[model samples]
Target: MRQSLFVSILHDIQQVNEYFIQTRDATGAPGLSGVQKMTAAFQILQYGMPANAVDEHIRIGESTAIAALNFFTRSIVATYEVVYLRSPNEVDVARLLQEGEQRGFLGMLGSLDCMHWHWDKCPTAQAGAHTGHYHKPTIVLKAVASYDLWIWHAFFGMPGSLNDITVLDRSPLFTELTRGHAHTANYTINNNVYTIGYYLVDGINPVGQRL
Candidate 1:
């Protein structure tokens, strides 16, 4: 990671929760500091390495490394969910529309796609239920992201056998739009004005798709 960016995250995380503070151990020696914990967590996440693979390098036990990862993820979510993971508001809608216009997609709010993440630890008995095209147990993740890389929507935990169409059938994004409470955007292109926004989706039928 870049030095400046890493330092910024360390400072922000410490600001969010004091649990990340480094202090003395039971023997009056300096214990694991927040920097060590964050390092372990980032390594595990960025490399997708086994939890134990980080123990020796980070100077932490396997269990402690895992704990640091959990704590770090939870802290980030708790501290930034409202700003980063929230549904788009009116202001956000306007900004997204402007961005779309600049990119020649006047009515586009974001792109949509579904991915399958293999579940390595899936039980044998439950494997058949989750096995899909990849011939392994997995879970589906559907996401809608804008040009700025802001994920406006995400739905996970679906059985892997389900295709993108089936996943869309169960997604709440459509239901919210149908209820008429979703954020609205208006834009003009080629002397045409459009009120409803659309998303660029991949490998899915658009029968009941949502933006």
Candidate 2:
């Protein structure tokens, strides 16, 4: 993550959770600062480093590092989940539609893609089921991101053994649309009106087996 973004997240997390705030020890010595705790947690999360490994760089013990990570994650979810981790509202849909029209994709919402994250310590019993084209065990993350890099939809935890189509079939990404709870986007292309918004995908069959 960029340093500025990391700093912003750290600042927000600290404001919402007192656990990240630094305090003094009983002997009048200064304890770990918020930066140290957040750094330990961020390193473990971004680099996939073990808790014990963070001590070498951040001077944090394994247990403390683990605690910091847990608290940091919980704080972030509590603080930002509502705004950043939700389906697009009407305003969001309007903005997306306008941007799409400007880009010659009148009814486009975003770009859809799947990513595989290597699972280094997968259990032996489950390893075979998680192995994929990469010849390694991994977990799949299906996401829909807008032009500004804002991920409006994220579905994760599927085994990498599943292909993009299979993963999409199992995801809740279209649940809202299927239930008619999705925001409607109406646009005209070549004088033809389209009511539903679409995501730009790769190597997938067209909807309803038609153009």
Candidate 3:
């Protein structure tokens, strides 16, 4: 059964766009371009076939199909970064913590878990990395906290191939709080260090920071 998660994906993409429209001044020009279309055509390649099949399914010329997939992939990746690639706002975190404390989340404004997103498999790369050791190749990760949980801050995208530990290693939050000499701005809350909040929760991998 060939199902299009297209509508759902588009909805997610729009959520990211809405973030920019609401929080920051709109910059740059209008919509996606021709090359972007090619990128979008590349999306079907994630289904485990080469370009031609995707083209046929979409009823597009080979080239045109490639263009759309290419466009969509790049634009979508950018959209992910735009929507999810940062920390949640302090205000949002505070509100969530308040509600969660009452609900048994217990200072649980933050959350952490692994997620796998499907993607195209590389020629030699084992399907395991992409598919969670299963059928489809995917980007896997442990994501902590959601934009919905936090008002002012955002959580962004990690590549499908990354585990939670790797994602946190590349995170800005870790560097600011745990690495090097910690400073005042490291834990700023309303211009005064907020001590009430609990720490971000993630993995207990050997690579993770130990208290």
Best by lDDT: 2
In angstroms, the error of model 3 at 104 is 2.5
How many Å off is the CA of 210 in candidate 3?
28
Write one digit per residue (lDDT tens) for candidate 2, span 1-211: 7889978987899889988888999999999988999999888887789999989878999999999999999998998999998889999999999988897778989888888899988999999999989999999988888878788789999998999999999999889889988889998878998888999886642221221
Candidate 2 Cα errors over 4 Å, as ranges: 203-211
lDDT of 3 by residue, 1-211 (tens): 2235654565555554442121323674454433334334545554555666654444456665665555566657776654455555556556666665565544454555455656554444565444444456665544455324322232354555565677667765545456553222223444765444444454632111221
Number of colliding residue pairs in model 1? 0
TM-score of 2: 0.89
Better model by TM-score, 2 or 3? 2
Q: Top model by TM-score, which number?
A: 2
After superposition, which runs of candidate 1 have C-alpha atoms over 4 Å from their true positions? 1-4, 42-54, 62-67, 187-194, 203-211
> Judged by lDDT relative to the true structure, which candidate is superior, 1 or 2?
2
lDDT of 1 by residue, 170-211 (tens): 999777689987777777767888778988776441311432
